[model samples]
Target: MSNPAVSNPAASSRRAARAAVAAPPPRPTSAQASPRPVAALSTRVPLGRRVAKKAFPPAVMLAVASLLVGTSVPANALFDPDAPPASMALSSIADAKVAETVEVEGQVIEAEAASDIATTAASRDAWTVTSYAEMLRLRYGSTNYSYNASGTGPIRWPFPFAAPVTSGFGDRVAPCRGCSSYHRGVDFDAGYGAPVGAIADGIVTAVGRSSSFGYRVEIEHIINGQKVMSLYAHLIDNSSVLTVGAPVVAGEIVGAVGDTGLSTGPHLHLEIHVDSVPVDPFAWLVANAG
Candidate 1:
């Protein structure tokens, strides 16, 4: 009972080899397996990101911030430790400018004040001079001098010198040839150059050279509402300074005594007139010259 296909051993062996060639390979173990190589990790960073990471230094950053904000940094802040800060230096400069401005303003004010003072002083001086001139003008009367005697009160002495009365007014022998038989005025034995003064406030009516009176000055006054005249005669040559129409006050010097003309010696001849009538001058002097 053997089959024909089973009888050949070589054919059987060849079929076995063909079957082995067609079969799948077996899987490898963990230790014997090969690992795939990972792609090399990239180490290079981007240029833009690298530059952004490197920050600026602190000092440079501060300077840049100041420039951007329009703030100034003093040069000394970097170079000099002893120098003032920027704010302090700015403040000092401002203060100096203000001081200079104040000084200039003060100078201007002082100059103006000085000018005003000078002007005021000049004006005051001018006013003073004008007032003094007016006073002088009012005291001296014009030509045709006349005075109203009403309301006038007492008077002063007529002569500045004190001396004895050598001759009395009224009936007296003539001292010189061609002189009058009656005397009209009293005589005082004052040495030459003795000062004579006005007895009362009055206006000078006459000043002249006369043959009988020599150099004489006449002043008309008002006394107790009555008009009167005072006469000073026998004055030294050129000694009379009064002029007609001038004003005179009591105790004001008019002339000096002399022996000119009909005078017997160096003496002063004083006369008083009431309404142009000669009167005793001694009685009037004693009554008023207390």
Candidate 2:
């Protein structure tokens, strides 16, 4: 029992406990975290962003370009170029009408205009073109063309009759004239009942009575794939015995002469046409007749 020198076990135990609690445990070493997944995420996000940035511009440009290209195409087709031009005679039936220009084609079954007008069907379709460029294209195009300026190839008599030509081609309007209009043909004074022969080889295109020319006959001839039509006016009634589509030789008798179709007297009114344009019969006769 020496009270002054003795230590208390509880207090000593408490103090030991306090000291143990106060001392810190050894810290863990600074081990780094595994970075594989984080690096993958970082690379993936950036690549996706970069690819999106690269693709956007080209796609927009392509869309814009397609819109522009669509608007440039022409709405309607025009006539073709690079083909040779065609010519039409001045005396053509087509030339006599409201047509100052004619369009010739390769496969024309009938002349663009005719002495006998259209009766059964509608009138011929006149091309209503918009511009001169289009008109030129029609003239020069392979399928369409302007009337040939030249006369029908090697003009011979539409009907064989002698010529010192009492009357000529052009307007023959006298006050007393019965036909009383632009004479669509030329008058050749031949004897009544003369045997009228075909000028060239042709088909019997038309045969009938006309108001102006009392008895009329028309022939369609082909030369070098061009159409040449001839009209014989003032023929004797019922003289056109040959039916349509009958072939006749040059200088073959087509009809007999008589005063008809507003003729002042018995004579032959001959018209020479090439691609439907009227031309001077005398010049044609001089150039091509035998």
Sliding window of 10 residues with minimal summed lDDT for model 1: 141-150
lDDT of 1 by residue, 1-290 (tens): 89756898888899899999999898899988987554444566788887766755666898889896565766655687788876566556555555565577555555455455545554665663456435534543222211222223348665543566776666555567876657787787767898887888899998988888898889999987889999999999889888899999887888998877786788889999999899878766665664
Compute each candidate's TM-score over C-alphas: 0.46, 0.44
Encode model 2's per-residue lDDT on 1-290: one tens digit a residue: 55532456677778889999999987766574344687666666577889999999999999999787668756443334553333233234344542432344542334444423432122334545477545544543332111222313344554433443445555443424455445455666668888777778888988888897688888998865878888888899998777788988777777888987777788888888989998876666665665
Which parts of model 2 are misplaced by more than 4 Å? 1-155, 158-161, 175-181
State the local distance difference test value for candidate 2: 0.66
Clash pairs, candidate 1, are: 149-222
Give the TM-score (vs. native) of candidate 2. Answer: 0.44
